[model samples]
Target: MEFKFSPLAYVPFVSVENMIKLVNSIGAETFMSELAVAIEEDFKRWELFDKTPRVASHSDVGVIELMPTSDGEMYGFKYVNGHPKNTKEGLQTVTAFGLLADVDSGYPKLLTEMTLLTALRTAAMSALVGRHLAPKGSKTMAMIGNGAQSEFQCLAFKAVCGIENVRLYDIDPAATAKCAANLKSAGVNVVSCKTAEEAMEGAEIITTCTADKQYATILTDNMVGDGVHINAIGGDCPGKTEVAEAVLRRSDIFVEYPPQTRIEGDIQQLPDDYPVTDLWQVMRGEAEGRTHDRQITFFDSVGFAVEDFSALKYVRAKIEGTEFFEHLDMLADPSDPRDLFGMLS
Candidate 1:
């Protein structure tokens, strides 16, 4: 007898190709803006979610991590890896996949390629924070370390925070050129600079995202002037940092989760007892974001799991009335709950 598969047996899978189509269909900037709203909503309810530092396994070459979180009803997790040397071998420096499952049933619901989703969610997160923390009426932004993430960051700020000009700089001229070219039609002025200092000229928001798995200072204290919002997203793991210690001392640091940021973010360079504001609290209006005009607001971003959970939830909702995903028969559901062995007959 040929048995039929139950609807519960299939899981919705969003492939890389479909994800690209979905982004194009919704427009990248709009997608990220919507994602930012979803993330901020989650942040408002931050206390209800299960939070922990991402579980990381480090090797000499790179690191692999599992970021997991749940809001008591829906559970989500992302498996990601960061290998800076992968670019030398013509591979992505960061790649990821994520899953969402029902908390009560413990069955997988949505599975999607988070590599693209991660980039969108990360840029959205940065811009969302910028909307709150960056200096008021900020227009120009200096983007250091132009790479796969640079274009998305530029667009997110433009769409969400009203940034008009983006000055780009990278160690590699080719990378700068690539970023500039990608942003040509993005409705923002892109300036390719030769040096990091040149890029920071007249910029209010500075974003640093260099991919080096070591302690490196992408921004010194002197480079960061008063009233600038620093989005430091590069230093994501232990021993990998991007800002100078002096810079950290001068800035009012904000982070997603303190326990994780202390271990992995640029704040890792500071002492254990150093004070940093929680981003969730700021979103919930319990804490201040930018107190004064000259007060430097440094966002030590290490890519938190809750943001990924928000991204997964956003994708799950968007794919409901669309064809951007496929149903994968990932579970074996027997017609009779106790007749699992008889399904094959």
Candidate 2:
């Protein structure tokens, strides 16, 4: 696993093609499971990390954000954009890249495309929370959004929580068909449903991930039953949400970070002081998860910086001694450290 170059001077880059090959080589299920373990480990040590809400710049059609965190030794940040309307033009709704840097040197150690990594980490985070919060012996999940992220969520749950079946529903029938086709040989049963209610049938975990700009209710109060874990991810920016307000009132909510969730998660629809359990605390055993079989546990996921940092760490470890990553000449090497013109000369 030794590097060919001095690690400080060369940043490893994982492109989309390389990332695809990496996932295929490790098998998607195994990669998702390992990534989930990485995320859980980071969450357990959350107190050591500097946490903050994502900084966002919004526009009429989309929003771009910078999510950054540090653990005293290393710093990581992701540059991501979300455009819900992009799908109409045959483009991805989310695109991202990220960097991991040495805290003291302030020099990047790795630069990688995060669009694929984000999907992997997000699914890992969701399924990891499901392992801790979902009904015991849960085997089925209802996925309400059948877009780009649907397949990853399905496989991650199957790998980590033993979910054997997924009922898929989307407003666009073609999306559901595409998702079902993609999951045909994924080793989990894929059911294409006509409505959200149909998708929820016999599902112990309900995941809502619709892409919309405004507060849209993908799941209503009546549709959500007791004893189910709700994974809400699409409501990542202000004014965007997927679950009903009443649903939030009935569930014991869990969040990555309360400060950010209040602005971007489904809890944004609730009062400022509404109760929430930080998921990291649950991982650290400072708080309880799924105290009762009938209790509704909700993971108001907004995709945190720490999760991205963990994913970056996992990718770096997995790509070492492999050709999945390329070294980029991102930093200038100067024999005279203080001479500005020495490197060029």
Best by lDDT: 1
lDDT of 1 by residue, 199-294 (tens): 999999999999888999999878889999999989888999999999999999999999999999999889998999999999999999999999
**For candidate 2, lDDT tens digit of each residue in 1-345?**
444334567888999999999999999999999999999999999999999778889898998999999999989999999888888899888999999998999988889999999999999999999999999899899999998899999999999999999999999999999999999999898899999999999999999989888989999999999899999988888899999999999999999999999988989999999999999999989999989988999999999999999988888889998999888877775655697586665
* Model 2 poorest 10 in a row by lDDT: 1-10
TM-scores of all candidate predictions against the true structure: 0.98, 0.96
Error of 1 at 102 (Å): 0.9
Model 1 residue 98 lDDT score: 100
Off by over 4 Å in 2: 1-8
Per-structure clash totals for the candidates: 0, 0
| Stretches of model 1 off by over 4 angstroms after superposition | 1-4
